[model samples]
Target: MAARVPGPRPDEERSPLAVVLDVLGADEQRRTRIAWLYYVEGLTQAEIAELLGISRVKVVRDLQICRQTGLVQIQINGRLAPCVALERVLVQRYGLTQAVVVPSPHDPAHLPATLGVAVGAWLSEKIGPGQTLGIGWGRTLHWSVRALRRREIPDLTVVSLLGGIGRGSEINMYETASRVAETLGAQCYYLAAPAYASSASLRDMLLEQAGLREVLERARRADIAVVSVGSLGPESTNRRIGLLDEEELPGLEAAGAVGDLLCTFLDAAGHPVDHPLNRRAVGLPVEDLRRVPTSVLASGGPEKVPIVKAALIGGYVNTLITDERTAEALAAG
Candidate 1:
């Protein structure tokens, strides 16, 4: 009979470190193991050293070597870079004035705040005295205001294309308009009315008021209009801000609405939806928005792709700011 076989010794059991050492060998193994142990296992350098029975200095050296040897490779997976490329593509395709693409956080919702910074920076540079600037508000616009770096340019006039004065968050159009005005050392022109009135006649009547008409007229005369592309669905700005109720949404859809830019919904091809809502809108018309030397900043995630695409196609925006995913989608389209 054969002699009873003995189980392998504890030392014979394979370790990830030992496997790595076997592959990389003595000269590089120590540093490779240090990097794997620290980064993969979430261990401190001291802890790694203690575990490896090596000096802390040695552990540090190994990590340095790992970095130098390309073992610490990093890849950014998001939209910002792609957005920049998209900016180029868009300019070539549509002859835009300027485009900015902000990167999205791994989570899409985080894109708004990140884009806010980019939009703020761009606006800070371009906004100044004697410029009639029009603003259309949304969540991304609110973030842009928060991200603005204040400047001392005087005589800036901020005109709101739509009214926002309901029981919503304090960070509504009024606050955003005020903040942008304060940041750029400009005067604020508030449209003190509802975002959407009950009917076209009511909207026309409201616009007839001298104070409201003046701002609306100035908005038409704007050199720059910062507008956000709005998507469909219940959580959309038009729905949330009470601009559109459920009863009216079907009509907008029936009119071939995909999304909206400044209260005008458009189809996949970027043509206006042409519903009664279009007639009632008090904001800048698509034709007017297109003709102006405006800077349009749009950011969000995949949800905003359709609206943003429509805006680009409609010629309402000369500049587009977006994230990586949206950029990829634009490129893909």
Candidate 2:
């Protein structure tokens, strides 16, 4: 018999970390640019080659040289501000890896758009060339995609974490991913199925589809994941898109559902509440998502506090993006 496999581990993370550290220590300008172009500017080797008037093979060599030397450094904005202070507290309180707190708007209606700007900019800086990103769809995520600046990130891939909503819903999973991909001139992988299946068997069949399977696997392998929470309100995509039958809403709430992520309902404690819909949902499971290297939970609004707090507490996300009011509210709780 072959060797037995043990439990899951992050042993694979060490190689990339060591390579990046070595790349950042080198003083060579071209090697530095190769790393910067790929990791910081999100350009692929081919694109960098074209821009620098070099061969694609040479571009690959230069990038490897970057890894051999020391070169890449990413700095988040650390200006001392009220929001920054709140971000610090949130990280400390929740054991978060990072937080991006925006100023609260007086008119709470503008909260999503305002926070969207912050998150969009943060994403552009965080994603590297030849990287993968998993994005969940919702109103806030839609706004964030719209706010993102158009730029090239060569070989970048954006994946839809959930399946589609209604046929024409503006914030469907595919729409969010395609919009971002268009902005970055990148690639995309979309699950070509509805958010939920007619039955658990049907959901299983859909997931086994060749194309969708590839997308789901890629989503699980993503280095960065950005997702949003959906409150259990009438305004939610589930209700608005008519995915949830009128009678089902009451049962979900009675089952202690506070909100949802990737169309899978979650309780106030961030555990998936027992519901029939979960078995039929065609989205990435929360457990699989938690294994992603960097998870960014971008959401705001008073209604989302419970779910957001739950997500953070459950270790679903390492980073958070929200407004000051929501931050303070989270702190108070």
Candidate 3:
């Protein structure tokens, strides 16, 4: 009579796979047991063979079979696992519908591309036939075009939430909207004016124009809105693009402004600052952004943490896509 091999000790830690293996067929159980002992338990192949009452050659062949038949799988526990955990915490903490936390790139310069691909993949999944997407423009959004999958969705429309810049660049609002629409093979709508009007009266005039009003209305009614926050620091895109004047920075800061969403400055507590630029900017109101069914905020980096938090606090973003480091900072705050 053969000696019965002992099963796992009662005090031993069992992986989920170990628990499920009890119900497998005898032959399958043997194969998986050998695999478990060799791979998970860190037993030498000779020890596994000896413990399972199998020859060393049989142990090797069974381990091979486990791999071939999908019984053995390997997953590295790394940054991705922490990222998933962060995603869960962010959703619960911020009352968000969803949160996507990506692993930070090794090179800080690659951050935009990292975030861009994530947003691109998310948009590909969310946007569909007959859907209207409203979008804000920035460097990160410009990079998103590189990863966006081109697909023709019938009746799909893309509305630029902000007006264009006089100085043309790839990251310009006009170019961003046109690129996104072209990539998705969707109809495109532009605001048909500069991002900021020359004067408050001119802004009002542009808002009342038949064509511009039509686009703004389309933006207000969009099924989804994707936007990014801008810091009030010296490196702010708004300043570089001439949307804001250097002399106005001190006044905005004195008014408690920390960042801007769609060119509307917001304070630490997420209220709009009492600044002339907010009134003069040509775009969808931050309040209107909240009304969109799905408003996605995509931005990252240490510099963006404050603004991102303000946006989250203001209820401007229901969905967030950001890097692991930024997610950690937000969670810590």
Candidate 4:
């Protein structure tokens, strides 16, 4: 029996072969060969046309007809690819907008600098003109600032999120904040007092100071806050650098604190572990940090993972930049 012909626009009952044979709008055989060679064989349209002694325009039309006649098929090798897939998983699992994982620093000392440069490059993309960026001071943040390239955005506002230096050795908070401000060519609103005072009453009184209050208010109004996570380990930079004191540790422990941001501790579940820092520490609260669109960049290896995990769970950051080893640890969790 002769095979039944099909219409250009096939209805429900048409066989695929009948559909293929339907003269959609071109030379079906030549078009099919062109499509097969161009798409399936990965030949360029020009190459296909040249090989077939046809014009590139003809090659394009032939391929289009091949598609119309159901003779063309294309497939993507992979979606997101491996690297992007991991990033997407982290974002979805942790409810984050973006996550960047840097390779483990060969030496502990260089980790900060390497990670910093990558993060700085990232921030270059994240920030734009007319945005207020709030920064917390620490060695990690300082390294990130160093990695940043200078770019002036006239409308950008840069401010310190916490009060300035106390007495410590890890990184100079004052220097850190100033460097970041200079790099961005943005105004720096320095928190004009110690991060911690002798007593809560003294802290309250200091908070009343005009300059300090102004900076704190600006911190609250910041569009994006960037901070580093602190671990409860004895040698933690927060403790070593005087960001937190020995006396404060007991209270934080009592409050289920595992790590902190701007002196606001977070528990194992990543929720705020409030304590005396609430009264004595000057800055936006951890909860407030969570409420704002913020990014947390922390690097240290397995030792800091638990604290980093807590930070993630607590909503202290919607974006996390860490080393590859730490990222695997997070994924393992």
Candidate 5:
């Protein structure tokens, strides 16, 4: 099937450069190849038109778009072809609106930091005024907060999607929301309750609280949600922050749980698994996330590749930012 493209309409307001570049920078492989061919391979529009079996007019338009959008830029080392190619593959494969893949470091331990900085840069480009951003917590997200460039957004609100993870680490739910809110010079709504209540009944009672209820409501209604996926390995943030017993891992694994988002466990297929802990969990449901306008998931590391793929298939994330290593792994699978 032919791929969709991203750009503004002819009548819409855009700089001449942006319009030209949009043509050249379109996600469709043919258009990209056309830009590459015309600029890099030194092919004329007519030659390219004959080569791709497309109309000469299309080649002209594509070239014009490339120029308008600044797709043609002089660089010291040239473009990062691998990351760009992988991003295109991911967008096509997962039906993502956008994909940002950063250079992967040799060590797996640093993937989150690398992915976080890239995600931060990507977010700065997409974020606008008056956006209510619902945020999830994890190591990668923590670094994202650090890397994010502070900006003022009028009436912007940042809501914590999960309940508090007090004093655990910099990546705690409280820390993530507060940091983003502070950076954006926006208001914040925190889920004051703990990540897991003492019991299902207690969870229900906590949910009934006016403060917690209000925040969760805002979270569900958020314009965008930024979250991370968690695998059920020894390095699992859910397992560590939940203070779960080692024995419980087997039960969750037995239940076919591969990973979790907002403390909602999921099977390999990304369906919410019927685990007993789910009843006591506090946060926005995955179904609720689907309702949000955009769900941005930033995660990487070899351990998370499978869960990330599951998240993609489950329709949990419309946009993804991760490291090239994980991106390549996802593409291969």
Candidate 6:
């Protein structure tokens, strides 16, 4: 199949340079040959010119045409060809609209930052003027804020999908929401309560409050939602940050919990686990995430693969961004 080159529409206004580039890119056969020699064979322009009996200037021009026409595509291939092949399989298997698989970092600890940069660049391009973005919090999301490119999007709104944690951290839901809003110069809304209420009644009462209710409604109606999955293991951010009690871990495991999205623990099947924590949790329901036009789930690591698959099974996320190792694991399963 021919790679589709995304750009301005034919009917849309174009600059002089764009027109000239389009004209230069019209010769498909010549551009393909040049791209093959330069990219696949690793030939320099002068060498390609000599071999093809063409001028060095034409070789350079044809190479430029290759890029402009999408005759040659560049991407990070972790295992040479597996990443691209796995991306297609994932998209088809899970019914996802899109899947991005980045090369895994050498150190396991760097996975969050690696996925963060990718998600940040995605958000920078995905969001536009007058759009509402609903976001969840985690270590990966916190790192994402560091890589977010500032944009002056008019009338953009950011809604925090979960309540804030008392313990201060870069991954705090309120902190992530506020930082993203600040970066995009957008209006911000927060769920003004703890991530987990003392009891189910208190969570219900907090959700009934006018301000908090408004924010939750905005989150549900957001144009885009971005979230990270959390493992139920001891090393999970919830455990590390003290949001979850150590004693509760055993009970959660007994209940068949795999991981969580927005602090709501889910089983391997993507259904909310039958546990007290689910009732006390304060955030958008996983089911409600499906209502959003586009929901992006970004996470990685061996422990998270099962939950990531569950989230897909539950239809909570339409887009997935993960590392190559995690992608391979998910595919194998």
The model with the greatest TM-score is: 6
Model 5 residue runs over 4 Å out of place are 1-79, 166-168
In order, the Cα lDDT scores of the candidates are 0.76, 0.83, 0.89, 0.73, 0.83, 0.88
Worst 10 residues of 3 by lDDT: 68-77
lDDT of 6 by residue, 66-111 (tens): 5534355454435547777889989998999999888899999999
> Which residue pairs of candidate 4 clash?
270-314
Candidates' TM-scores? 0.72, 0.75, 0.76, 0.70, 0.75, 0.76
Residue pairs with backbone overlap in model 6: none
* Regions of candidate 4 where Cα sits further than 4 Å from its true position: 1-83, 167-170, 247-251
lDDT of 1 by residue, 1-333 (tens): 999999879788787987876887786766767778888889998999899898999888878766434455433345445566777886777677776766567866667766776677677777777898888888778877755666766667898877775676655767788878887788889888866666899988988899888887888889888988787876686677666777988887788888888777899889987788777776667777776777685666777888888878877788887776677787777
Indicate whether candidate 2 or candidate 4 has the larger TM-score.
2
RMSD, every candidate, angstroms = 16.1, 16.7, 16.2, 19.3, 16.4, 13.3
C-alpha displacement of 86 in model 2, angstroms? 1.4
> Model 6: runs farther than 4 Å from truth?
1-80
Which lDDT tens digits does candidate 2 get at residues 232-267? 876666777777788988889898988887778888
lDDT of 4 by residue, 123-178 (tens): 77777788888887665677677556577977888888777675544466567777
After best superposition, candidate 5 residue 45: deviation in angstroms? 49
| Clash count per candidate | 1, 15, 0, 1, 10, 0
lDDT of 5: 0.83
